[model samples]
Target: MSAPTIVAADLPAPADPLAQVAIARAAFASGRTRPVAWRLRQLEGITRLVEEREAEIAAALSADLGRSAVEAWLADIASTKGEAEYARKRLRWWMRPRPQPLPLNQLPATAWIKYEPLGTVLIIGPWNYPVYLTLGPLVAAVAAGNAAVIKPSEITPATSALLARLIPEYLDPEAVTVVEGDGAVTQQLLAQGFDHVLFTGGTEIGRKILEGAAPTLTPVTLELGGKSPVVITADADLDIAARRIAWVKLMNSGQTCIAPDYVLVERSVRDAFVSKVVDTIRAFRQEEGTNGLRIVNERQFDRLASYLDATSGEVATGGVVDRDRLTITPAVVVDPDPDEPLMTDEIFGPILPVLTVDSVDDAIAFVNARPKPLAAYYFTKSRAVRKSLLDEISSGGVVVNHVAMHCLVPQLPFGGVGESGTGAYHGKWGFEALSHRKSVLSKPFAPDPQFVYPPYSATALKIMRKLF
Candidate 1:
């Protein structure tokens, strides 16, 4: 079957949120997306979209967030492509239903779970990683054989417009549609009652999404943000840890939800780790030939600048901020007060705070006392320390000896707990999250036991009870 023709001009003004959902739902009802071949075709189309439009995607990202070509490729283009490729390769196994053993009571019965698509779903993307966050969830929706309506972040207008133009050309236009708008538009879409809603954004906005979907009773998967912490033990390789932390933290000017929001190091090695991190940050900036990192907008720039202003701790390096340029040099804060905003709030900028702890236990205790984060990172060589940290703290996911690498792993379920967020989706987890597992049981005609009838004798009742 040929792909449907959908373009910006074909869509209604403001995209008529209800009409978009209706179109996808109608397409889903036709059952064209149910076949494995069609699903694979859609997934491959996404891969083609990335491959053919690499330059356009990179340029859009740069225009929206000032992300360099290399950063754009790694975070938006490559990561999304990897997810599509991974899901496409394993979709067959994921679609196959596994045979399940029956209980003793049902002697001649067979049971298994079949994964079915939720008619039509909505994916609301965030601006920080516009292409990846938007397309990433779409990958899951498509892999699950469901129709999808994608709402790219309005904050990244350039990327959003690009997606609106490109998605229909690449994927099944009727089955998958892109609706571009702001928070009000998102609220309007949520009011239309989708099968499932997956939103990636801040906690406050997540709450609103949940509230908006409440009337429709739509199941929602919120990939919200929080103060994801990094614990550095004495036994960890400080050099490697510093490099990894600095590398991820500086990516996209630290706008990532899973970026190390703050670091807690053992008191003994605190000074050394801080020094290494400073050197690493400096070296990275020098190599990139950029002294200051660009913030997404003036509001975010002011917010990050305020954190620097309020902090009572010593600024180890890179505290300079250019308000007019909307950029702040990567700043490292040492021993910031626990009650201050720098430590309390999720610093979604190019600022790093390194706090000294008495021991690994202290670091774990500190993390446990706060709301659960989206992710928690630990750098330790000792197995005991690693195990202890894993068992003790609660988070969406964990990465040992590195930071933010878990998000790249397609096999792992990525999400948050408590205030961080709810639900998980990546590869099979993503497919499962968007797909419903329907339980099926088959029985032979001979297995219609008379004991199960309403009119039963004492012996029949006794036998039924025993069997049950």
Candidate 2:
């Protein structure tokens, strides 16, 4: 059956930036969102939205991103539903305050941390993975009982418009608002002073977001991208490594932030690994019945094409570029110059570069020399090698024998360090990131002692110091 038509008129009407923030602030102030039942209901709403509107979401994603139905479900729809369900089951435990033991001198006082919402927050989402990244942060916001504003990326208009239409239908419209626009609109919303802001996009844009939020003193969480690298050791299962790396590298046409950007293989097995990867890509394309992967826009297409033009590496297989179609055959370049554009830039495309290293030490040194990545993947059966990679690499997250799986598990915190990005959010980490842990202390007046006052004798001072 064909999908229903979604015109511009069908989308939710855009709201003024000032009024959007004001309405969310009013909703938060009304105390309607503070209760656990309300928070859980919002989570349930999100799960229902993903469930009931599955086909519509897939259609929107296909319109905006040219994604297949299964890809859309795996990357955005299922991932989001999993996050909401995970948080919904354990939110009460996450919300409960834990008692803290007081010092000997303060025995009569009880201390604990109370989790509370940080008023209203803003979620500025990226073009890639629009549904998951945008609504993923919203799960945290509502889970912590804060009102929110969702700013979907303008680059993917269909997904943006679909989110604008569906969010209010599923969520509390008064507590959660969707404001659709470009970067300028995001800047205007930032000016309105939200309690917190979570942005998922590229690094340069993350810097711009930081600058925009600085004046308002608003806390921001950045889920930015970098050249996430994958290392293949001689001891690693060559076929398994090739398939895993190829699978994730081709996901969303390799636009994923945690997708393996480049491969660092041990020189002894570099040729075998590269050959297997090339064979895997061919098999995958043949299986999918597609000649090329889709690029989001002409600008991104031109940028990716330029990298291929300037690369000092051998284009091993599939360097075909069709600008008119905005699609590029998934190309595997063997041993590109380290300083070349393909090596230096975050290749947010189907282009994958394989660089050879002498040993695992060289691989570790090579990754460490550059800015920390959002994720680092090492494929090896050697526990020593795995431990070395885990111990030495300073990345947002690491996966052994797998690529980009860390982000899928809600138990792990997902965010970059150094230049990649800042702050983490998935499950409990997300809840705490959006919530303010207020410290509470209660004391009885009957235990008040004159010796604890401002004036003190020498003996009292000594006693106080000893007690403290």
Candidate 3:
């Protein structure tokens, strides 16, 4: 089936930047984003909207990237649905006022943490996993009770169009709206005075988003990508390590922000490890209905093709490019020079690089040299190695025996740190990001005697000493 067409004329059309802010502010001022019942309704609306439009969603995905329907369901739509359900079920518990204690000296007063919405929120989503990226933050915003304007990636036109058409039909424009355009529209939205802006994309764009938001002193949460590393220690299970890393690295055609960029295998088991990776990539071929990898669009296809360099590495397996399908066969590159273009940027495709090293310590050092990644993975039976990796390295998160599974746990905070980007979200963290944790303190109306007041005579000091 051919992809659906979204003519420039077909959309709600881009509104003036000022108008977007004006509408969002008005809705926010109305206090629509703060009610728990209202938030649950929005969540329910999103779920029904996505389910009712499943066919269009699948077709648009297939047309845009040739992704199989099953893959779309598993990789994209399911997560959004799950997040919506999770938030709706738990919002009451999450929105409950938290209690705090005053010291014995101040027992007469009471204090508790209050959560309040942070007016208008701006959400900028990435092309890879467009559906999940778009809706994930929206769920958080709705739960936190904030008006949001979501800008989907222009690179994936079909998904972007489907979202723009369907979202407003199910949601109130004043509370939740979809805005579309190129980088220009993105810049325009970022220029506004949003209470909070949550962006999920590449680090390069993450930086630009920061630059735009900085002037307003607006708080921003950046979910950026980096060279997420995986380490295989001497004592690790070779086959299990290979299969786990291979599967995650190829999921979404390696477009995941935290997919393993390269492997640092212990020299003693290096040969066996490479064999296992090769075996695992081959296993997917025999498995029925495997959406092994997908090439999202032409620009990315061209970008992946242009990255190969003869002097950089040795291709150990399939490296052919199927231009018609925009599919590149999974390939393993070994001993790639540290300075190769592959190492320089986030490789958002099905290419895995393996570098052998003497010790886990060496691998840790190599990863530390790069900017702090969004995630780091280590495979080992030894508790010492795992502890060292956890304590010594800095990342948004760490996985002990797998890659990219940190996103599954609803309790853990998800977001990059340092250059990979800063600010965290997911579960309670997400709610907090879209809301304010306002602190308050109260005292008795009755005036109390000040033991150390300016009547600092010797007799007054003796009485104050007893109070202390």
Candidate 1, 1-468: lDDT as tens digits: 434433445655444778888889999999998999889888888888888899999999999999999999999889999999999999999999978998899888899999999989999999999999989999999999999999999999999999988988888888999898889999999999999999999998999999999999999999998999999999899999999999999999999999999999999899999999999999888865656898999988998999999999999999899998898999999999999999989999999999999999999999999999999999999999999999999999999999999999999999999998999998999999999999999988895877789789999999998999
Ranking by lDDT: 1, 2, 3
**lDDT score, candidate 1, position 390:** 97
Model 3 C-alpha lDDT per residue in residues 233-341, reported as the tens digit of each score: 9899988899899888877778789899889998999889998898889886566333335688777877787665442778887667767768787879887888877
Q: What is the C-alpha lDDT of each candidate?
A: 0.93, 0.92, 0.82
For candidate 3, list the clashing residue pairs, or say none: 33-145
Question: After best superposition, candidate 3 residue 186: deviation in angstroms?
Answer: 0.9
Report how far off residue 161 is in candidate 3 (Å).
1.2
User: Considering only N, C-alpha and C atoms within 3 Å, which residue pairs clash in candidate 2?
Assistant: none
lDDT of 2 by residue, 1-468 (tens): 212322334434535777877888999999999999889888988988898899999999999889999999999999999999999999999999989998998878899999999999999999989999999999999999999999999999999999988888778887888898999999999988889999999999999999999999999999998999998999999999999999998999988899999999999999999899999999988965656899999999999999999999999998899988899999999988999899989999999999999999999999999999999999999999999999999999999999998888999999999899999999999999999999999988886778878778998898899999
The segments of candidate 1 whose C-alpha lies over 4 angstroms from its true place after superposition are 1-15, 287-290
Ten residues in sequence with the least summed lDDT for candidate 1: 1-10
